[model samples]
Target: MDTPTEVLHRVFGYDSFRAGQQEIIEHVVAGGDALVLMPTGGGKSLCYQIPALVRPGVGVVVSPLIALMQDQVDALTALGVRAGFLNSTQDFAERQQVESAFLAGELDLLYLAPERLRVEATVRLLAKGEISVFAIDEAHCVSQWGHDFRPDYLALSELRELWPEVPRIALTATATPATHAEISSRLGLDGARHFVASFDRPNIQYRIAPKSEPKRQLLEFLRTEHQGDAGIVYCMSRASVEKIAAFLVDNGVDAVPYHAGLDSRTRAAHQAQFLREEGLVVVATIAFGMGIDKPDVRFVAHLDLPKSVEGYYQETGRAGRDGLPATAWMAYGLQDVVQQRKLLTEGDEAHRRRQALHLDAMLALCETVGCRRVMLLDYFGQQGSEPCGNCDTCQAPPESWDGTVPAQKVLSAVLRLKRERRQKFGVGQIVDILLGKQTAKVLQHGHESLTVFGVGTELGNAEWHGVVRQLLAQGLLAVEADYGALVLTDASGDVLRGQRQVPLRRDAPRPLRAKTAAAAKSRPAAELPQEAAPVFERLRAWRAATAKEQGVPAYVIFHDSTLREIATLAPSTLEELATVNGVGENKLAKYGEQVLEALTA
Candidate 1:
């Protein structure tokens, strides 16, 4: 029998497992249960995929998303792997064919949803026969306090009771401290090996900007910064998704929208267009994208803020999945805070606590000025040695000023209005009230002459607005849940009275798309140039091909950076290529001739 390493190349195209992938897979192949916390783009799928093909019996993958199941099965089928999915999307006839295949041992793996696994008949079938492993994807949803909680997932622990000796593995892209604990207990992991991979992907640059003419800013980014690439734009509301997609199309982008409001056929069509075409920007609400597996997404733009940092990380990690350079762009503001807070307060108390934690993490992402990559990794329990130089802050650092005076004005305005402590205030009215505009509220309240009024004229409108968001995020400012009015919390007194130097980054928004932004709409969005991209890819294929011939990691044959440089240079001889930076002494001496031959071939 061929070893697991041999099956990695024979059944799958990969030469070897990634950093921590082999360890996790070996444990599973040894018939041990595992709970994994791997970051997006960290090759979590491979941990179970290889072992499923190598070990005995069929592997049962219980996934939460139907769209993800379809895409994953399609990819596996394309690779000639005996894989299929059983979901609501399939017809009865198709379901019967898959069931027959599963019983006949014609399939190596099958994807099922939580609903399927919880059925009495499904449990009986599994108990009657031998199964390799019960892999639970998106396991964090089982945690009631998790950001992506689902009531159905709460019963997932029964998998342990049903198949205590069958071996199990749970995986997710993001998990906080509380969520991690809950997953272990909820999954019934009495003593399982915890395999947590580093979340840091230094190639993707992280950025945040205040909300301002979001469509225009998105246009500018598409035109100049990320022109002619694949990307996803997330909005808070379905209307915003439609409007943003329409605006992009009208302005010159071949953009599309996806939301639950859209029919299944339309959503599938749009998703297919994005996966096949180049430069197709998908404008979607949080509900639209879950397990989208398009690898060369050059950027991800959030027109509105996400509910939590876990959501943000999962969304942004979709970019640069192919280990290439990418951007994470977001336009956030005080309104997002109000909207998300409303979402939180309207839910049950359990949901509210999780929502608050999610909000705090999002605020941290917005306010962080150090290494964007480092901060994001730190949230996922990964550490980075250096800040990636590509992020907005690391690239062009923002300048901040002491915001004590602005905080004082914001606090005073909420108090002088005789407002209940929870109402939301728009920037215009907030500014007008602070400057004693006497527009109606000021005249009615007789507060035009109050010391707090007009004292904040020193700071511009934009600066004051930024101060409001910072204070709101810091928990010093609150909006009444019943009335949607602004109020000061008990923590406000310290910040208002010069007792705190409020840390604020330069109040910036995503740059506007240039006039040339529409030109890329004329071409394919996903396909890159055939010469260099294909050549670089060939070098990668050759590395994978050659690595399998020898038993070593592909990096041992040629690093991706080296192959990329070789594809660009395409040197005919060893002497001319010595100048390439990635082609150092050892690499130049070792794989130089073979790489040159492949390039020339």
Candidate 2:
């Protein structure tokens, strides 16, 4: 039998394993259960794939998405590993052929949707096959508190009940300590050996700017730094998705829209285009990117605030999967906080409280005056990470000032309106009242007569907006769910009573032109030396044609990183090309001659 290292090189074309992989692979190959928490691009798949190859029988993998399963199987098949998947997208004949292959021990890996385990026929089919390992991809979905929870995953514990002796490995790209514990408890892998990799992705630069003209801001961001790059733009609503997509397209970006409101066929087509094409941007809601396997997504921009930090991390982690430089940029403001808080006010008290905790953490991350990466890692219970120099905070630190007077003025306006006038007003009226604006609404409502009117004349309109946003983030100000009117929380009373102080973050003024970061100015992952650039482009052209003929994404044929290495090395023969990091024996045998010709041409 081939050892794990042998399988890794012979099939997957890697000389060594990444951190925490070799031990986990050997443990599972020795028939031990494991729960792995690795980052998105940290190679979690190899932990199971290598063990499956080294072990005796077919590996059964439980995946959550049909696209993910198909992508995995295609990539595996390209590596000469016999891989297949059964999902709703497959017709009966196709499913039967895959099932027959599994039964006859001709397949190394077989991917199944979590929902498929509910079928009696699938259970019988699994029983009939000689199984090696059971791998659960995206195991965080089993947690009720997780961002991407799937009810079908709760039934996965039965895998242990049905096959007690077969080894199982559960893996995910994002999870908090609490969610990690829940996954273990719910999946009945309480005693499984746990592997927690570092949650940091240094290749992704995190930046958040105050929202002004958000659509224009997004366009400027794209045109300035990320022009013609493949990316995903996340919006909070379907209307925003459509508008943003149209706006981008009008501004000469190759863009598409995806949302749950769209029909399944349209969504599938858009997703396929995103996977298959280059330099195309997709504007979407959170529904768009859960199991996306695209490796070269250069950035993930959020036009609205994410409900939680986990969601933000997972979405941004999609970029730079090839270990290249990428950006995680967001345009956040007071309305985002108001909308998210209003959302949290629904459901029962317990659910509301849970959601409030999530929102509070998210707000803290946004409002923090310190390092963004430090707070992000700290949230996942991984500590001792210094301030990473890659985020907005570390690059240009925001100032924290004593905003007690400003906080008092804002709260006093809300207080007097509620107590004296029996009225509540939204941010616009509150800002106007503070700035002493005698606009039509203020004059009509007689808010100009309030004592707090004109109290905030020392600060400009934008600075006052910053004050209100920070107040809302600190929970001293709350938004009424129905009308988005500013209301005082219990914490507001302490600030007004002089019993507490408010230290607010003073954001740097938005520059006329955004100064691109040093990291953003670096070359992309696929970039090569001047002499090798033409060779890389030729090889890419060949890969595009081959993948088009096969009806698979270009990365499934050969990742850009592999092509770059090949272009630099300029190997002449299959034996020499096989030594490249991503050139497995199967790939070298299939495409080596063509690659050599591309090099010469």
Candidate 3:
């Protein structure tokens, strides 16, 4: 077996391992197990990948996603390592080739779904051959409490008994205490060497707004902040996906919709196009985006709240995967909460409880006032050393106020309007009633005649919108019962009678409109990225093809930036590649000719 450093250079390109990586890889290489908790883009794949190479025989990787598996394999093959996978997506000939490779001892890494691992053919192959290690990516799926639980994942426990001598490593981008314990128990990896990397993503900004003319808000965000970055817009339903995708297209944005409802070919086409196309925003439901392989997603905008915090974190984490700046923007209202609740109620009892817990976590994220990055870090039990200055609150401190009076005014109006019209009023009409907006509807109702009508006039329309959005976000408004109307929550009722005071981010615009394109240009143009630019993309495509042949994540072949370096320098020999950042001796010795052939040719 090669030294860990040699494995780093030969099979994977890295100058030296990141903190704790070599140690973790050594533990597994020595036949001990490991459980890895690393955030998105934190190099989690290397822990198992390196060990898989140094160990005695074929390394088996269990991944939950087809695209994830495909991308990984493409990246590995690019590095000239023999990698393969057997999944539902594979044709019979492809599956047979993987088996042939495994038997011939030609494959270094073999990717499989948990279900495939349980098959008789796979078990027989395992029994007949030397198995080196088991690497489980997205390990959280093994836990029942995990946000994305799969029945097949529970069967992975059999691997511990089936191949007790083979070391096991479970990896995921997210986990909490309950999930961690569950993962340990489920995978039988208790007391395994555990490596927890920093979960902080300083590149992502967080912002939450109420769901009012939410389309206009999303458009303004797309036009003003991030005009050319890849992004995902998540909705709760396929219908919503289609509608929003169509809307964005109407507004002159390059957009597409993806969900289970669409034909599989159509879905695949849309996905491939999104990956290859830049500045493309995909409107999708939960049915899409898992196991997605596209890096460089610039933002994740939620037209509705996600079902749970873990779910939200995973979805939003898709953004800024390359560590460039990105935003996580959420627009939600009372209707969203009600819809989620109604969906949960339709499921089994255990599912309902899980959904409730998930919804509660999402609610906390929506209303939190502390540093969002800090809050997110703490959520994963990570103690960030400093606040991330990239988020909204860090960008512009929110203006606060007692808001006790305005809160009372808004709630009292809801109560009175409920008593009088026996109808819940949408926030705009309710606000107009309060501001005494003289409209035909106002005259027909004579709503300006009420005491609460003009009390809120002192609060600009935007400030009032913020108040109501906060209320809806906090569960103080129920929209379904009101039929898209906003009514006071039970908490709102208590506050209306002066039983409680609402602390509000009291200064928001009266209303949002098509924002004027005002560019406050940066003082100095930022220099190009650390890696060579332009040609870097060609390097990535080359790496992707190589990794595909080897069946490993693209980073195993070389990171995008490292490839960029090769592109810039046209590294023609092992010596040249070693000089590139992250290019270690092990990688040069193994793949030097392959890289030189590509570049020098």
Q: After superposition, how far is residue 287 of candidate 2 from its true place, in Å?
A: 1.1
Worst 10 residues of 2 by lDDT: 517-526
Residue 441 error, candidate 2, Å: 1.3
Every model's TM-score: 0.84, 0.97, 0.83
lDDT by residue for model 2 (211-320), tens: 99999999989887887789999999999999999999999999999999999889988998999888899999999888788998999999999988888999999999
Q: Which candidate has the highest TM-score of all?
A: 2
Candidate 2 lDDT score at position 41: 89
Q: Rate the local accuracy (lDDT) of all candidates.
A: 0.75, 0.90, 0.75
Q: Rank the candidates by lDDT, best first.
A: 2, 3, 1
Name the regions of candidate 1 deviating beyond 4 angstroms.
383-385, 419-427, 438-441, 496-501, 508-601
Measured by lDDT, the strongest candidate is 2
lDDT of 1 by residue, 1-601 (tens): 5567766655453456678988998899998999998877788887888778788888999888886676677556544568888888889899888887888788888899888876777677666556778889888888875667787777788877777777899999888767788899888874999988777777677878767787887887788766767799999889999999999999988899999899999988888677655468999988766677666687899988887788888888888876876778898887787666656676778667867887888887787777677778777666655777767677666667676767777887777655433334555677776765778865765667666677777777777777877887878887667656677788888876778777677743444233244443322222444577778767767876776565343444544555666777778888867656445444566577888888877
